[model samples]
Target: MAKNNTRVRWVSIGLTALIIIAGIITAFLQAQADIEAVNTKADAIVKTSEVMKIEGCLPSRANGNNITRIDTRLDSMQREQRTAFKEILRRLPNE
Candidate 1:
């Protein structure tokens, strides 16, 4: 009877310690996984924002170039009309 009691007590203590160690390891692994997931999500968000900014800026830059071209054409047309008007007025005065 004494032999059984002592062996059983030692076995109970060993099992309890093993269970606590396993729980601690599992918790640490879970925390590491959660931190990695959050970091991945943050990086994605930043990349998406950078892409959107680039896309948005390009269209406005194109629009500014288009505006400049339109202004140049308008100036050329105006000069042509002025020259034509001057020639017509000269002919009418001579007649």
Candidate 2:
């Protein structure tokens, strides 16, 4: 009877160890997947930013200054007006 109890205790301890190991492996895999997903999103955002710059959808830098010195809302309004003026100019017939 004592031998049987010892065998049962050993089996229980082995199962518990395996369970803990499996949990660690699962957590590590999940962390790796999360990191990969974040990297992919960051890459996609960089690509989109590049495309927007190429298409002139992003803000243009000042001729002399290297930084933006105005309010963002005001700058956005100005850009909208500029785009509207360009569209109007394109629709105008040549005299």
Candidate 3:
């Protein structure tokens, strides 16, 4: 009888440990998903801000001599594309 009770106790402890482990794993996965979602949103916001900046500088982009203009829009991160475009434009031949 004592041996049977010991076996049952061990089984209950094993089950409790299993439940705890499963909860930890679930929490870890949920945290990872939340991080990925935040990262995706951040990337989208940065991309949108960059596009708006380029659009805002459209007057300077009217000229056809603007390949560097496109590259500059992407390179400045959060600065004015015109600033970089002007520098890059000077290096190119007149078009």
Candidate 4:
């Protein structure tokens, strides 16, 4: 009878330990998922802000000044790109 009691006690202790470990693992995974969700929301907010900035920079029909500024900016960007392409072509080896 004493041997049986000892075996029962050890089995209960093992089951309790297993339950505690499982709870800890579940909590850790939940925390990780929460962190990922927050990061995803942050990324979405950043992307939204970037799109808003671009929209603000673009010209609207009601704003003639913005249209002129955007056209000037586009012209400068095209010139810079053309210059960079010419430089790249100059650097290539003749085949």
Listed per candidate, the RMSD to the true structure in angstroms reads 18.8, 11.7, 12.2, 5.9
lDDT of 1 by residue, 1-95 (tens): 99999999999999999999999999999999999999999999999999999997898787874777778999999999999999998889554
lDDT of 4 at 50: 100
Q: What is the C-alpha lDDT of each candidate?
A: 0.93, 0.87, 0.89, 0.93
lDDT of 3 by residue, 1-95 (tens): 99999999999999999999999999999999999999999999999999989897786657765678768777775566677788898999997
Cα lDDT, model 4, residue 23: 100
Mind giving the per-residue lDDT tens digits that candidate 4 earns over 17-81?
99999999999999999999999999999999999888876656457556678789999999999
Instruction: Kindly report which residue stretches of model 4 are placed more than 4 angstroms away from their true locations once superposed.
Output: 59-95
A best-first ranking of the candidates according to their lDDT comes to 1, 4, 3, 2
Top-down TM-score ranking: 4, 2, 3, 1
TM-score of 2: 0.59
TM-score of 3: 0.58
In candidate 3, stretches whose alpha carbon ends up further than 4 angstroms from where it belongs are 59-95
True-vs-predicted CA distance for residue 77, candidate 3, Å: 35
Instruction: Please tell me which predicted candidate would have the highest lDDT against the true structure.
Output: 1
Better of 2 and 3 by TM-score: 2
Q: Which ranges in model 1 have alpha carbons more than 4 Å from their true place?
A: 58-95
Cα lDDT for residue 82, model 3? Answer: 75
TM-scores for all candidates: the values are 0.57, 0.59, 0.58, 0.60
